[model samples]
Target: MQHRPQNWILILDFGSQYTQLIARRVRELNVYCEIHPFNKDLATFADNPPNGVILSGGPSSVNDENAPNINEDIFNWDVPVLGICYGLQILAHNEISGSVEKADRREFGRSELIVDDNTDLLKEIPEESVVWMSHGDHIKELSSNYEVIAHTDNAHVAAVRHDEKPIYGVQFHPEVVHTVYGGQILQNFVYSICHLKGSWTAKSFIESTIEEIREKVGDDRVICGLSGGVDSTVVATLVHEAIGDQLQCIFVDNGVLRKNEFQDVLDIYEDQLHLPVKGIDASDKFLERLKGVVDPEMKRITIGETFIEVFDEAIAHDDSYKYLAQGTLYPDVIESISFKGPSATIKSHHNVGGLPEEMNLDLIEPVRELFKDEVRNVGRELGIPEHFIKRHPFPGPGLAIRIISDVDRPKLDILREADDIFISELRKNDLYDEVWQALAVLLPVQSVGVMGDERTYEFTIGLRAVTSVDGMTADWAHLPHPFLAHVSNRIINEVRGINRVVYDISSKPPSTIEWE
Candidate 1:
């Protein structure tokens, strides 16, 4: 992947979800950057050089003997360098030592960043600004050459910088929104140090991505997996516009969809968009393979494996197809940064996982460079419908993860109907778009209830609706008591087997939006 001699930055990924976010922030500054594995050669960057470099946070602890690390040459690259989270830990280890591990007291949430009032890094930020900290280890000691530039209540070395060098490190994750001065910190690195011009926008990304797509794909046919999610839909649309009708989208219905989702997705993606989309109704195949599998992890693995088989078989006859286009957004790339380290939440969302190793085709990830909001901006540029652009977040596993206790069709259908009513009422009450995501889960727990003179034993359905800027952290939607009452009544009255509905009011940390 040889990028042009443009204003480029290189993001050294240590497998953190914030890696792509780091790149997105850079690109937002109109300075193009590419993410590479830390083990990749750092010297090639000497000639076709990036203006600066950033090291991404990872899921691994710096104290772990086998933790992923960047080559030391990164510090000597003669350019500005920024290290984040595990990136900071690795840097501290490479130079300094004794970053104490506090596994029992990991800094996993918001913290106040106590910065040196005169420091350049905290240029625009206040001295004691709030920042997101998510690491288990802290710098107990620093290298003789490095100095502590920032601190927090718990960790003395929240940030470090070599006095004589351009390299810098921050223990807290400045890429997340929880960090009050995160964007300012990133801007200081980009504008003040690297001096990158903030000229990049969604328009620029679209034009450049289109040109790149045309250059690589040429006359070859490309097959995209359209999930009807904003990321995939935008990617499919952008590719179609780039190559005209050469891109074929194979949408597989994995029997884990929401109520009437199969048709709704097709209608919006196929008919409305006028793209070359083929709806492969492989619901039965997926359902059969998934029978009696109740474990959430097992369900994801099986669904991912079977989806490959289904997608592979669906496009096997199209001999001209040589590339697989995915709607993989910046978050997807950032979230699965390690490619090996699974998410902390254990909830497999936004990922279909990696394709089979022997798929033998190149991957076309058009929107892989844009964030969720940036993708929507590009969608607006491409004339996408506002409703489609602003739709609520749905898990990549579809409805499989929402059903708490079972994966049977009868239970799935019931869950789907109950979920539809819940969401529809949210819409009718003008509260749908306000929430980040809303879903009804079928609980395995059964309870006795009386309805119309008969006693019934049925599963419970839990409803969750949240409001968030992105899926990273969310707060429960504040429903008017009357509205909640109306929604509860509709689900219990209209959807059978669900005599009870409970609303979840927890945030993302303690409770993920999904029940399972």
Candidate 2:
């Protein structure tokens, strides 16, 4: 079994969009936490109970016929329990069926929270402060065993606590920033009430991960695919530290990478980090399979399948390799096990999903439980260069999805040049680290434009730059107009890609970061 921190928080997710945010907040306190579906069997954690339990808010009302019910087993654990918006209502409804009902005035935004008592959960919070409220239902009456700890003008039961148990519930969302003292309230619960120390840090994680990897892959050879990205690099470094020369890493050039990215990344893998690595130039093979593939889904499948084939060929003669290590992160794991059911297919990832099944190898994902930023921390702890650690996230499919048309050599060349200019200018102007991700897309639409004094019809290049904490949601970066003009002029003037350039101004809801 993988080694995890002994003292951690178990967050039961109720299909809330903000559920992940709660986990993020907990991890921000340097306390480890994991999110599981609301209906998960508590018996699974019987051997290793969490230090505390947090019930996340959801969209469903407790009165609904099919509303998600509470797993009463949590209380049996005898651990400190805290519930937010919908969570609070569920606790009350569990006591009496009709205890929670629709409110006459729904609170959707900020409100003044009046503190009736500030002994424990509400400790350090001000008497009157702004708190965010998004629920439409409110508790009509509290159980005789529970006492009111705080209230608001619209919600008398804004906060409640059990008479004797260390259980608490709050109508307002303390996981959000809108709440004035939200962090303080959570600190109070995590530290004072649950008595958990903030000891989960980068150094501890690296030490534990190396030991676990060593135990799991003893005397067995492991093969890892390198994408030159932070996650894979960190995984490779960690595995190498555990088993040294027993880990073999392969970096494949898929023909769709950025300009000079293949050699540049390979040099770092060999020289800077000094891991056992092999650079495979299968660009011709990848490009041949990608020819005439116009649909984005097909493009991703082609790349993923091609990747598996190349990796399989590279290791076909080596029967000693028994494990395949991937750079899968926590968000991907959470989305796979979501209780909300399968969401619509926006775009398929380019990871080699079929590698293990085809290659007959056990899988190893050391950072599978860490978020993107957390992986960066692990990378830093492993002594990866700071510049490489902060590199913007690149899709596994590379420039395939960026081109909104059929893949081809000329188109790839045009995109590479345009993208190089945009990215280089961002760094030159000290704006590279400002945005989470920035890229240039080659649009299929061709428009008329004038360069010098001639009318020209050429494909337009779309420039996208976004500010985001995680790629889950993003807003278009409001770059300085003058700086954008400079990049646009350079792309149009330098790259021979006929004419026009445009900037994407849409956010993640209606439009994704990539055009495809």
Candidate 3:
């Protein structure tokens, strides 16, 4: 793939949990960046060298016998460099004059940062600001040519910079939201030190993506599984533009959709997009197979396998379509392929695994390189309505995961009704766009309640809404009490079989956005 010259940043990942966020932050600045493994060969680096390079945070200790190491010549690549977290420790232990030592007290959360001297990196940052630290090691001895620019309460040498070179390192993570002025620090490095010209935009991405898709799927029929989410909608639109009438979208309603979402989405594809969309009603089939499954992983595997079966069966007699296009994002690919990050397998996405090898379908993932917000931007470029582009994200397995336990029609109905009510209230209060993703999870346990002076045993539901820049990390939405009370009351009173409700207040590091 060809790209514009001198507008990209090369980020080498060292297995940090926040590595993806670094790329997201740079992209948010409208500057292009690419991530490669920490041990990527020097030739790959020489082939398309970026204007600047970034060393990402990692979990491995620099003193470990099998620690990940980079090319020593990267320090002499002439391009500016920024090392973060473990990256800082690596530099201290190797290139610069500093000794890495395990801290007496490990810092795991927010801390106070005091700037000893305002350097180029901390140009406009406040003298006393907050930062997020998650390390058990710190720089004990500073190099002769390096100076401590900033320090936090827990770590004395929180940040350091080279006196002559454009190389800098920070012990704390600036990619996360908990760190104050994190974006500013990155902007200072990207724009001030590297002098990057923010030239990337959604329009240019769409044009290149469309042209690539056109060349890839030349005169061949493509079948895409449309889940009615922004990712798939935008992907379908892009592919449709590339090869008109050659793309046939199949929407499989596994009977686990939002209330009236099946028809609503079908209407959007037929009436609004004016494309060839086939709606497959496989609710009964799915429910029949999911009769007594309780484990979440099993549930996901079942849904994914069943979906592939449905798609294969639908296209068994019709053999024109030869490609299966999915809306698999970059994070999905990273998580599915590697177990090197801080967090382990939180959960398996339906599209991530469990497909039989005999399916014989070539995948044409148009938007796999994008994140959720980027997908929305592409949707806007493709002339999709703002309302559709802004819809909250929904998982591929649908209400099956949200139900949390054995599947049934009554449970699906109750969850769907409650989810619909919760979403309606969010939109009525104009709080939909403020959230990244929101959904109601149906708990397995039931609760006792008194309604109309009668004792009743009903199901309990949990409402989850989170604010996130990308789906990689999330913080629960701090919905107002009045709004929560209203939505809770509506769910308990209007929707039968759901009497009790609660809200999830956990962040992504501790809890995932979904219950299952």
Among all candidates shown, the one with the greatest lDDT: 2
Task: Estimate candidate 2's RMSD in Å.
Answer: 2.0
Higher-ranked by TM-score: 1 or 3: 3
- Deviating ranges (above 4 Å) for candidate 3: 1-7, 40-47, 71-78, 96-98, 104-134, 143-158, 161-166, 177-180, 317-320, 334-343
Ten residues in sequence with the least summed lDDT for candidate 1: 340-349
Count of backbone collisions in candidate 1: 1
Deviation in Å, model 2, residue 332 alpha carbon? 2.8
Q: Which of the numbered candidates is closest to the native, going by highest TM-score?
A: 2
Q: Once superposed on the true structure, which residue ranges of model 1 sit more than 4 Å away at CA?
A: 1-49, 55-70, 84-119, 125-161, 169-180, 301-317, 333-337, 340-351, 360-362
TM-score of each: 0.81, 0.95, 0.88
Overall local distance difference test of candidate 3: 0.85
lDDT values for all models:
0.77, 0.87, 0.85
Per-residue accuracy of model 1 over 328-426 as CA lDDT, tens digit each: 654455444444234333444334353454664577877665557777888988888999998876766788888875588998889989888888888
Give stretches of model 2 more than 4 Å off. 1-3, 335-347, 352-357, 509-511
How many steric overlaps are in each model, in order?
1, 0, 1
User: TM-score for model 1?
Assistant: 0.81
Cand. 2 Cα-lDDT: 0.87
lDDT of 3 by residue, 1-516 (tens): 233335688888898888889999999998988777887675765766788889998888887877887667776678899999988888888855338878899889999999987768988899999899999878887777788899977788888898888889999999988999999999999999999977778888888777887887777788888998988888888888889889888998888888999999999989988768999999899898888988878888888888888888988887877888888877666655553433456666778764555675788787666778888888898999888888888988889889988988889989989999999989999999899999999998888999999999999999999999778888999999999999999999999898899999999867877888
Q: After superposition, how far is residue 286 of candidate 3 from its true place, in Å?
A: 2.2
